[model samples]
Target: MRVEEIMSTPVVVTREDTLVKHARDLITRKDVNAVPVLREDGEIAGIISVSDLAATHFDDKKVNDIMTKMVHVVLRNNRVVDAAAVMVKHNVHHLVVMEEGKVIGIVSSLDILKTMVD
Candidate 1:
């Protein structure tokens, strides 16, 4: 299967200026592990994850303050195995899925595991 086949779509994203508390709430409500931080011009700036939030004490701070600037991404057309490889190589749990230079979805390690189980 392809990354797009199992990736979560309609990605939930956040702005750099968004409050940490808000981002955390968004993640909890959406049941996602992370969200991509986007620039005003719609480009990806960084990423914020549940682990990032949990490791910090800045609920009132901006998302940018705790976001990981180096975001790993996978093309939507890539194979699921390729996505898993990226995750393993980067020691990351999630990756932003892109298509035509635009954020389209996200894939997590758990997603890959679910595919294998099914």
Candidate 2:
């Protein structure tokens, strides 16, 4: 199967301007481990994960301070196997799914597990 066929769409995302507290709240409310960071034009800017949040270890820093600017992404049409390999190689739980350079969705390790099990 392709990433597009299995990936979750309309992903939960965060804006660059969103505060750390709000980002944390969104993650908790959505019950997701990570959220993709988007720019004003709705482009994929970066990614903010629970690990990234915790790595900051500062109560005062903002999301921008902790979010990873260099994101590892997969094209929506990519093979699920290729995406899985990237995730494993990068040691990342989430990969931003893009289409024409825009954020389309996100694929998490949990999603991959579900694919494997199903």
Candidate 3:
């Protein structure tokens, strides 16, 4: 199995300059636990997750204020085992999936768990 084979699709993203409240709304409405943060040029700047949202209370803050800068990424075609290893090493529940240097999808520990059971 590969990352893309099990990753979540229709990835929702938030711009770095987006307000924290708006980002939270996007996450909530998308019904996802996390979102990839994008730079002005469409590059993956970092990631924003529930944990980040929960850790702050600044209504004026932007996504860039709390998003994790060190994003763990996996190629779309990478092995599931490799992706899992990266998750464990970084202690991250989610990873940004890339294809040809573009954000394509996202894979989380939950996705890996489902793969194991199936």
Per-model C-alpha lDDT, please? Answer: 0.93, 0.85, 0.94
Each candidate's TM vs. the true structure?
A: 0.97, 0.89, 0.97
Off by over 4 Å in 3: none
Local accuracy of candidate 3 as per-residue lDDT tens digits, 1-118: 8898999987999899999999988899989999999999999999999999999999589899999999999999899999999999989999999987789999999999999899
Q: Residue 20 lDDT in model 2?
A: 84
Q: Point to the candidate with the largest TM-score.
A: 3
In terms of lDDT, the poorest run of 10 residues in model 2 is: 55-64
Better of 2 and 3 by lDDT: 3
Looking at model 3, which ten-residue stretch has the lowest summed lDDT?
A: 58-67
Model 1 quality (TM-score): 0.97
Per-residue C-alpha lDDT of model 1 across residues 1-118, encoded as one tens digit per residue = 9998999989999999999999999999998899999988899999999999999987999998999999999998899998999899999998999888899999999999999999
1 or 2: which has the higher TM-score?
1
- Please state the error at residue 16 of candidate 3 in Å: 0.2
* lDDT-better candidate, 1 vs 2: 1
Ranking by TM-score: 3, 1, 2
Q: Is candidate 2 or candidate 3 better by TM-score?
A: 3
lDDT of 2 by residue, 1-118 (tens): 8898878778899988788888988999998888999888888778999888777666456677789998999998898899999988988888888887778888888888899899
